[model samples]
Target chain A: MELAQRILVVIRFECRRGMILSRVATALVLAVFPLALVLLVRTQGGDLETGPRGPGILFALLPGLTCLMCLLLWAIPAIHSEVEGSTWPYLAVRPGGKSAVLLGKYLTAVAWTTAVGWLGVSLCAMTMRLSDRLETWCVLGILILLSALAYGALFVLLGVVFLRRAMVLAVGYAFIMEFLTGFIPAVIHRFTIQYHLRSLLSQWTGWTPASLGGAFHQLSLFSPWPAWGHLLALLGGTAALLAAAGCILRQRELIKPESE
Target chain B: MDGPAGTMILLEHVTKLYGTVIGVNDLTASLPQGAYGLVGPNGSGKSTLLNLLTGQLRPTLGRIAVLGQPPWNNARLCQRLGVCPEQDAFYPNITPLEWVRYLLELQGFSGSEASERAEAALEQVGLAETRRRPLGECSRGMRQRAKLAQALAHDPSLLILDEPFAAVDPLGRRRMVELIRRRIAEGKGVVIASHLLHEVEAVTDRFLLICGGRLLASGTAEEVYALLEELPKEVRLRADQPRRLARQLLETELADAVRLTGRDELVVSTDSPGRLYRQLPQLVDRAGVRVFELRAAEGSLQALFDALLRIHRGMKILQPRD
Candidate 1:
């Protein structure tokens, strides 16, 4: 088969396998988790728009927390599970087969995470009563896509590099690099995916608050990079990481003694 | 690419090492078309050799070619190679049909063509009835058949199976043996590995023996058994008038040491099996002894392996200071 067709086979296989009722239900619950928080805050007589900047707590929850969480859950296991499950050798022998499998799995993780991110952001925007739903959806939609791509690529790299320790390493990277380091008011903060995402979020949404809270307010201190700049960086970063992962996979032997 | 002259697989001074532990040592071998068994004990590099042959692993310090091309990352050559690994893993929650079809599609076959081949392969492995069932729900034996189905689904020119009879029962083993024979009969070359001596013996008389990641021997069963010239062999005979038979055998020096086990049974141990066998019939005829059964006291392969292993250990113990 052509490389595209082989990739599609894997995509179809992954998507078909992901449609189990239990998995779908878990994804739905996770997609709704942030939206549930929005509803909870509203029920407590708090205004959804009461936050100091951005799309209040709803944006933070949807594109910020939910997107990262879903992709982490979906993308990290995308390749590691196959390697750990001893299914990689079966696929690795085909002509140009490893790239096909890797790209297919990467694409599948992006699709699933992107889908869930869109669902969560849509419901969050609806519940929070954003004035311009289209613009909110558009900006959040792009951020969600970018987040999925960047996190999916990084997680795939982690899966390739650290086969057994991928999940722990990814969780550490997510918590430290994406969450904690992204908020620090320093040049190092710019290294995080969250930095570009927040930069893009601020640039597109036009939410330049004078003063807010803690690091959330400090994020407004840095000059917002042009929307194109952040988008380009995210795309370039994702491509570089994925290509590196492919190279690593081609170089490393995936088989272990136990598997033999 | 066509294979070299008459050779299907050729390895020249191939050595594979995993850190300090060796997987396959400095070894060279050439296998021709038709069927051959790879026999070895666990961790003796049977799977490692098959992996190298299938292009799943590369040699550390030598060259390997299957059908005239290096197997490492050689996609074109991989199209002509199929491997059934020892691990029992299948794509999760999917029917065997879908799994097999997907693998065939990866080999560049279109969906419909892949489906047809998958069905036929599954049928050949006797999985036609349960082809639609989820692999996770299948028995160990059925799953083994499924593994074979996928490997054969592409109908590659060379089929390499690693420990194909690992977890199979007697009946399943018989079925697998038949399937392997059928594949070989179709003019495709096969290299099957198993630690089970009887399993490999049942499939092919031509076999290779590997131990300590080295090629110990390779030939027909009789030829390999002939390598055990240093080891004594015991043969038991049950016959009427056994005393007369034993007396003739002792007088001729044919029996190195003969012991009477029962009223009509004699166990004879000899270093020269050929001379003993040549003299046994004459002695029985001269004594008018009616021989009912003549059997090796131990499994030939097992006894040879034990002797080789003992010599190997002896060499290890006698090693010079590093």
Candidate 2:
């Protein structure tokens, strides 16, 4: 086979074998999981109101929730594992280049993250089309996809910095930092990709967003483009982080201690 | 290996410095295509050398080329290289069948070929029956086999195995040795970094004996060892009149090679032990000497290894004559 073909084969193979499980994990959490959770909540609450003025809290279920959950729980373990399995050595040895390898996996994570997140939000949107909020839903969904790219790179950097405990750190940042300070002043909240994501979706979904924990009204912040601009910057930042991390990994001195 | 690339690996004054400590220093060696054993003690830098060669670790100084390409960051270079790390890190909740399969899959094997090769490779390493078990559940030896299996499944022309026998039981060691031996016989070049000299000496022809991150000696096992000399070779003589035989032998030129290690046992070191042993009985009979013990002093490989270690601890290089 030609060298380029071999490189492509390796990159695709890396994507499929490395992240397939994490993608499956993402699907379970973002799509089937929320569906199950909603059913369970409604079982005891006795029939959710779906007829008149029924699109109340259901709007909050769209766009950013599944993306956030998947990034936090699923992407955390996935990125952190690149080190643990000793698979990096194998990947580093291939001919396609580490950037290509990282790009392939990053693409896989983004696609899976977007697909599962969209799947759930689309479900809730289908039910809420009664309120003519399709435009709001569409805009919010695009914003979530953009925000996920930034978060994905941030998590990838976490993996490179903390090889063993990257998972714990990613999870902590997701559940704690993002969840806590996401609704502060635009300047402060800009640190988080999810803050911009929620800002873009909160009001249009008929759900209230509180970056300062109920301090802000429903999406009443400044326009969403600044957040969008910052999101793109984050996207570039993720790529840069991945490139730097890949370089470090390339030069890293791996002393493999004799096994027990 | 792209037609051997004429150079399997080369290290030019390659050194790895960790803080003030030196892992490898001003070391240089060129490796061609063949199965070479890297035999050394715990900190002999065998693993470090392998890491440097395979692109897992970069040298702190100098240059390294695997198959004529710098081993660092060049994924294209790695396509022809395969490495089995010494550590026993595994992905939990995954089977050996699945794990090795995925690793091969990452090497760009199609689904069917990857699965088939995974099975064959696992079976070759004696993991076929147990491949379905999650790696977390596999025993230490099994995990090692799984690691090796994945490395071999890629059919890399150069296979680097770091302490391949580590953590394996005696039986497992034998199995691993056979696998390595088989791969080598098939004309695949292998580099096994290990401390078990007996194991290595038995399987490999050429050896790189590393000490203190420097190449002490590289040769056959026998050539690298310190043979017992200067110590008199004790050849026991069975004599009737012990006093008379001792005086007779001591008076002659042959006495220089003789010494008494035990009563009734006189050890003799002769340029020709065979001639002396044949002449002893005739001399004993002629002199009316009593006879009892007859033997030669023996040397052990373990003692030789220890002596080499002691000598290497302070020396920069081993004399070729030792």
Candidate 3:
């Protein structure tokens, strides 16, 4: 079968049936949050509104916050849930088959975070007359997508590496990588998906690569291919990480004697 | 009851090493496919053998062929192979009807055919009532039956089962054995790994005994039992005036083999059943004792298996220094 077609099949079949309550939760998050955010935050005058900032253009592009949300809320804990319920043995292994179960799950996150999540941002953008900011819309949506891949890959690796304590480490990584990395300056900023993504989005605010851009440039995440190059670099890097993970799962015995 | 011409599985110099540590050491064995029972203790490479046989794992250093084809990564070979792993991992929210149907579809069964096969498989495993319930809600035995249903749904030519009886209730285990026996009667091949020798003895016509990561014995259960011929036969005797009889037997020509087991019983291992049978009436009269209980203490199969296991255990104890 074609790889893309298989991935699409997995995305549809796998995402639908695993968890009933979680399915409802994702649906609610998809359908309700977009409509709710527009009503609630459009009136709030704090950093949520932007009359001088052009009535929420800054806030409309704030799905860069989903960089943080994707790591903590979606990517980090999602693996914990699957592993706790013992789904990996089915989802992970098949003889002579592609080892890209991650693409299915990663697509689920991309679907919710991009389609539903950015729709929320778009709704707030439209409510405040900030919908015409095409750069803001594109950057916000793309950043959320990148954050999903980067953080999703990291958490998937954690699930493979520390199978027993993956949940614990994934949560800690979420807090550390998502919350704390932005505080570190210079080269350290590029290491966190949150930093690279937000920095790229802040670029849509018409800022230079001087602060965010120069830091991101140091990571070799950007080559001559420019933005798409960096996207593929991040993708290729994630694939390499997954390759390392495949080595681990293939080699390590899942059921050790001590437990049995 | 099938002859050697019906042999089902073959392994040559199969050694699976987990890094520097050994998993299944150099093991070689072959047996016909008709309801073969694999008896081994914990960590005896039973599960590893089943995994290697069913294509779930590739052997590290040797060739394994199941039902006349290489199993590892060969989809065509696997279409004829089925496995029931000991692991408890299945879809939680979907009914067995859904999951089993999907698995058959993966094996290339058409939609209607897959559904029919799934229903028949579930019914054969006696899980019809709860086939439509989400598997996560089913009892452990029901879930195990559901797994068995899917394995059989494809009508696999060879079945490799890793501890299929584990965690199953007595009734379920009995039904499972019957199911396997039915398969054997059809001349299909089955390799079932079990810690319990007696449990498998009834279902399987052949035995492959493994111990301490190596093959210990093979062939029919009787043949494996015959490997323990060196162990003494335990003949139990009960008679009036047992002490007096024991005293007289201790002094008799073959007396060195007898031991007083209870107040009125003697357990004897005899090299010559003929001499003992010939002299017993005369000995009873001479000792003024009336003979009562006289029988071999353990069943023939159990005695043979125990004796062989003792030797394996001895080898295990001696292996560290070697």
Each model's RMSD to truth, in Å?
3.9, 6.1, 6.0
Docking class of 1: medium
TM-score of chain A of each: 0.92, 0.72, 0.70
- Ranked by DockQ from best down, the candidates are 1, 2, 3
Q: Identify the superior model by TM-score, candidate 1 or candidate 3.
A: 1
Per-prediction DockQ: 0.61, 0.30, 0.20
lDDT of 3 by residue, B195-256 (tens): 88777786875777777677777777655444343344556889877778777776886455
Binned by DockQ into CAPRI classes (incorrect, acceptable, medium, high), candidate 3 is: incorrect
Fraction of the real A/B interface contacts present in each candidate?
Answer: 0.46, 0.41, 0.12
lDDT tens readout by residue for model 1, B125-147: 78899999998888888888888
Q: What's the TM-score of each model vs. the native?
A: 0.91, 0.74, 0.76
- Writing each residue's lDDT as its tens digit, candidate 1 over A37-104 gives 76777789876654443264555776678777777777777767877777887888888888888989
The residue-level lDDT of candidate 1 at A192 comes to: 84
Candidate 2, CAPRI quality class derived from DockQ: acceptable
Better candidate number, 2 or 3, judged by TM-score: 3
- Which residue window of length 10 is worst by lDDT in model 1 chain B? B313-322
